[model samples]
Target chain A: METLFYDYVVPCVCAFLACVGFTLMFNIHGMGKLIAGVGGALSWLVYLLAGSTIFAAFLAAVAIGVFAEIMSRVRLCPVTGYVLVALLPLVPGGGIYYAMRHCVAGETQRFLSTLLHTFGMAAALAVGAMLASSVFRAMFPRLRRTGKG
Target chain B: MDYDKLLNMAAELGYQLMYSGAEIYRVEESARRLLYAYGLENPEVFAIPNCVIVSVDTPEGHPITRMRRVPPHGTDIELLERCNGLCRRLCAAPPPIEEAQALIAALPEDEPRYSPRGVLLGYGVAPAFFAPLFGGGLADLVSAFLCGSAVGVCLLYGGRFIGANGFFRTAVSSALASLLAMALVAVGVGESVDVVTISTLMVLVPGVALTNAMREIMAGDTFSGLSRTADAILVASAIALGAAAGQALGGFF
Candidate 1:
């Protein structure tokens, strides 16, 4: 129970707060900010529930992308705002930090391995987000009609 | 309708979209739609990262082209959404050229949506919460909050002077934040300096660039996608380099 509280509940709350911060920093306004925060919280919740792995990060990113799309449609805002803020918690900052630390300490092998891992993680996130957005685009043909007149 | 004014307005719209960090295809699509709604036959719109080019054939069988060099600004989602809504409204109604011009000129200037104090609070709170997500403990959370506030101060103030040079601003702020985190750990304030540093820097990472780059590639804009990918890599490397420099300096002190 303690583990669940620490691992899932705490992070979810933090993620929600962090997402709100990002919404403010990114200059998102109105109720869209709250929806963006929910998008971030949802992503973090999925990430924690899916366990710790590269695949988990990918799935979480996909969840974020899809949620952002829904929010964009509902709120009439750009997806760029919500999607970017929501994915902030999953960015490979820790991996990049460790990679740089290894390089500074002259641990070439460790640096290389860490850098590769970071690259893979970033790639997974990118692919997942791309897939989700692409699916959204395909599903909503009317949304693409920017030339109504 | 004067073709010159119409072309100018369309190009200006594209510039606004690009400046707000909209995707390249989106910019091009918006420009093309605006021109088409304004009675331009077969308007050709091409938007790169830094420039937008639009061309349309006149009644005299001559092609008139207008280009605008849009200076990139920080992502302002409010402005992007407003401009997008304007485009959609224009498309649906095909407003007169004069009305369209007024609408474009009336677009809101970029402004911070929150007060300075609120922004600072957000900066501190975000990293404080992110610390635990990245495996930091209670002590690390407090340390990260402090370090993140320092970064927030640097961004709020240093940005006024160094806002023009994005690379230098990012590097300097990131290095200073990492240095503060390291000092806190050295003073027995945090359990792991690495976790604190990582969590604090999360706000500055290039997650949006990476995701946009992939989406651009999937949308068949390969050149833009590749360039965006390179940009993301460069920014990531800059943050890493700054953190390493900070660690070296901290070790010396």
Candidate 2:
């Protein structure tokens, strides 16, 4: 368990910094900062423990989505702020960099493989977000629309 | 007074002005000293294109009532033009922070606020790329693109309506752009390479990453934000992956 947690720490830290950077860059609310940090960290942890980025992404998103919905209902933080920050960890930058670098270096076969893997992950991540959201929306019903839930 | 110094001070405080008209009242050295220098007021500053109006409704005992517009930052077509040019130049050249301060000070007054709406649309590579095809129309496209890009970057944070709308809008735009690219190829209007480049690049713009990033930090959900940021990175990677998939599929044809 300790080893597993340690493995996730790196990705968690990366997501945290990215969230902080975004907040500072855009000037978001304080509560928004907290929610985003928690969401991003948890999602990365899920990925590390499960070794499945898609599943991890889904779990994190759903968790954030549910939390945001509840918080908003209670008249606390804004739901959008929380969800937006929490989604940062799933962008796929490394894949693009790897593929582009390989392609530029003339490693055609490797580039193709890496490129496909990157796309697969990307598609999976989007589906995960959609699924998480849809599930939450179904459960809460109010969370689907903007004003009521 | 040094115009540049004034602008520099405001920017440092993260007070970027938006819009301007004309000054209604003048608070000379005494008012300036009390207001600007002493900072004895929590004024609500409303900005237009080239004007700034501040209402002195603080310190119930301070005898100052009504609103006033101060032109410490000048507003003329030339000034507006200069500021616009400066905005672009600074975005491109990115001078030292101190130098930027100086330029702002020299300008004499706030030009307007810098809104990020246009920036997101620019990344789409072309405006009206999906106006005719998408059900939501131009406004919808703009709103979605802006909201998605903002949410993606952690900019404005969330509102499920914005996210849902943004997702649907972007997907439609993506499909529309894709179709256009394909059509262009069919008509021989552009080379296959051009079609691929245009269509694929549009998909790579990371709206989710930006939005989530900001919300995570501001909400104090550092741990969660970190996870989401990773997810965002994965999403961006996936877009490139999608592009590659399309590329490979094209090759088979």
Candidate 3:
């Protein structure tokens, strides 16, 4: 129970709150902001459930993109506003830091590997978001036709 | 509407979207759609990180063009959403040119939803939660909270002097944050400095830029994609550089 709480529940809540903070920092408003926070939590939940791998980040970002698309349709806002903040927790901050630190410490091999890993994670996130968004864009011709989105 | 004014207004709209961090395709499409709705049949719109260009063939067969150099501004999703909403509404029922111009001019002045204090509180508390997610314990959480607050204060103040230079602001704030986190760990106030540092630095990371860069590339805007990717790389390197410098300085102290 403790492990579950610490490992999942707490982190998910933190991710949600952190995304809320991010949305505020970016000056996001209204129902979209609240939903964006939920998207953040959901993405983090997906990340955790997928075993927190680079692939997990990709899958989580796709989930976030899909959620943001639905929210965009419902809230009548751009998906950029929602997806930008929601994907924060899965970004490769640690990987980039370690890669740079390794480079600075003269560990060339470790630096290369970490740098590549960070790049891969970033690529995964981007590809996932794009795929989901494009899929939704294709699926929702009605929304586009009405010019409501 | 006069062709020059219409072209100018369309470009202005694109500039606003770009300034608010809308993706390249969105900016281009919004400008194009708005132009088409307003009776400019052959509108050409192009946008990048730093500039937007709109050109349309006038009734006289001459091309009227307008361009705006958008200064870098922080992302404000509310403003982007509002502007997008404005575009949709205008497209649905084309507004008068004067009304459209007024709306475009009014976009930047929209007030933020959260007070400064609320934003600061977010900055302070977010990293505390982030620490646990990064495998931090109780002590790391507390330290991350403190460090994140310091980062927030730095941002609130440093942001003013730094202006729109994202690279310098990120480097300065990240270095100070890393130093503070390292000092806390050195004094045994935090368990793992790595977790605390990473959590605190999460706010400054360029995840959005990187993600958007890929999306742009996949959408066939290769130039914009590459430019945004370079930007993300530069920001990441700046943070990494700042943290390294802080660690080296901390060792000396």
- TM-score for the A chain of candidate 2: 0.76
Please give the lDDT score at residue B213 for candidate 2. Answer: 40
> Across residues B75-126, which tens digit of lDDT does each residue of candidate 1 receive?
7788788889899899888878888977876776544468887788888888
Sequence-dependent TM-score of model 2: 0.38
Tens-place lDDT per residue, model 3, B1-253, is: 6777788788888998888888888899999999889877779988878889888997788887788998867787877877888898888898788888888888878646677788887787778778988889989989998999888888887777776578888998889889999999989999998999999999889987887788789778999999989999999998999899888888898
Indicate whether candidate 2 or candidate 3 has the larger lDDT: 3
Better of 2 and 3 by DockQ: 3
Candidate no. 3 TM-score: 0.94
Among the numbered candidates, top lDDT falls to 3
Q: Give the residue spans of candidate 2 off by over 4 A.
A: A1-5, A9-14, A52-55, A76-78, A143-149, B1-253
Compared with the true structure, what per-residue lDDT tens digits does model 3 show for residues A16-85?
8888878778888777768878998999999999998899988998999899888877766677878888
User: Interface RMSD values for the candidates, listed in order?
Assistant: 2.0, 17.6, 1.7
- Model 3 residue B57 CA deviation (Å) reads 2.4
Going through the candidates in order, their DockQ values are 0.69, 0.04, 0.72
